[model samples]
Target: MKKLVFIFALSSFALTACSKPENKPVQESAQTAPQESAQTAESTAASQPLAAGDTAETSLDWAGEYKGVFPCADCEGIKMELELKSDKTYELTEEYLGKGAGKEFKSKGTFSFDTKNPSIITLDKAAENRKFFIGENFAEARDMETGEAIDSQLNYKLTKEAN
Candidate 1:
């Protein structure tokens, strides 16, 4: 067993010691590494130009009144007006169109922007999870409980009204 081990080790040493570095021409893959890296950097810059370390919370002029008409199943439509202030506060007014003309539902609360996702804001209410996706001069209503984007084509977008 000792003789077999000694022979195996000697053969392995001889095989490895006899190997030499190749003197072949460089491949195209090695030459284009810098080009590929530059392309990667350019693509990254182009893709994230609006979001490259600039979230909606930090980069947008978001403090204004946004008005929109949301679809309602039991009524004509829901007229919603939301104003996000600079002091981390919000005012929301909703009116069911077909239900009544002057019957407005009003609420005021403090809202917070999500730190991890920077575009999502949650209304500071305990009874419900009223979240909105903050965009450039607009806010879109999200799901009630999960804060996910509403998967409907009924135009949940609210446009920023000029103040």
Candidate 2:
């Protein structure tokens, strides 16, 4: 077993050492340049900010369902599903895991972009819940009254689900 391990390690080092470096960087190579350019174009599209009343979806199409399990203080996590429509309506279904498992809460309301920041969406006054910072592919959950991001070990942003 020891000899086999040593042989494997030596062979791996020899193969790595024998490999030659490319003359140009991968991004600049002919074969990879087109792919890299496409990726750069997509990144540029996703980075552009959307304006209020534009009625156009974000670069990655923000009109969809976003689901995530957010960190919770007492419970295991809070499983949430938020659906944002092009018509400016939203439906949020949340269930607290573990301790509050069977109890699900659903909040349906109209959403509007924040007056000062178009990317930040606020729920109707009735919901009185947190706002979401809209991005290309995800909406980050934030504190309602304070507008501060929710601190958590787990990812606080809801990932978009494919239709």
Best by TM-score: 1
In the range 1-163, model 1's lDDT, one tens digit per residue, is 9999999999998776665322222455567778999999999989874564588888889899999999988888989999999998888999989866667888887998887678999987741558899998899998867778988878999999886
| lDDT (Cα, 0-100) at 2 in candidate 2 | 100
TM-score of 1: 0.68
- CA lDDT of each prediction against the hidden true structure: 0.84, 0.81
- Model 1, C-alpha of 76: deviation from truth (Å): 0.9
Q: Pick the candidate with the highest lDDT.
A: 1
Put down candidate 2 lDDT per residue, 31-142, tens digits, no spaces: 7878889999889879986444463244437789999998888998899999999998999999999997888889998988776666778989656756998887789988
Give, for candidate 1, the lowest lDDT window spanning 10 residues. 19-28
Separately for all candidates shown, the number of backbone clashes (residues 3 or more apart, or on different chains) is: 0, 0
Off by over 4 Å in 2: 1-60, 151-154
User: Candidate 1: where are CA atoms >4 Å away?
Assistant: 1-38, 42-53
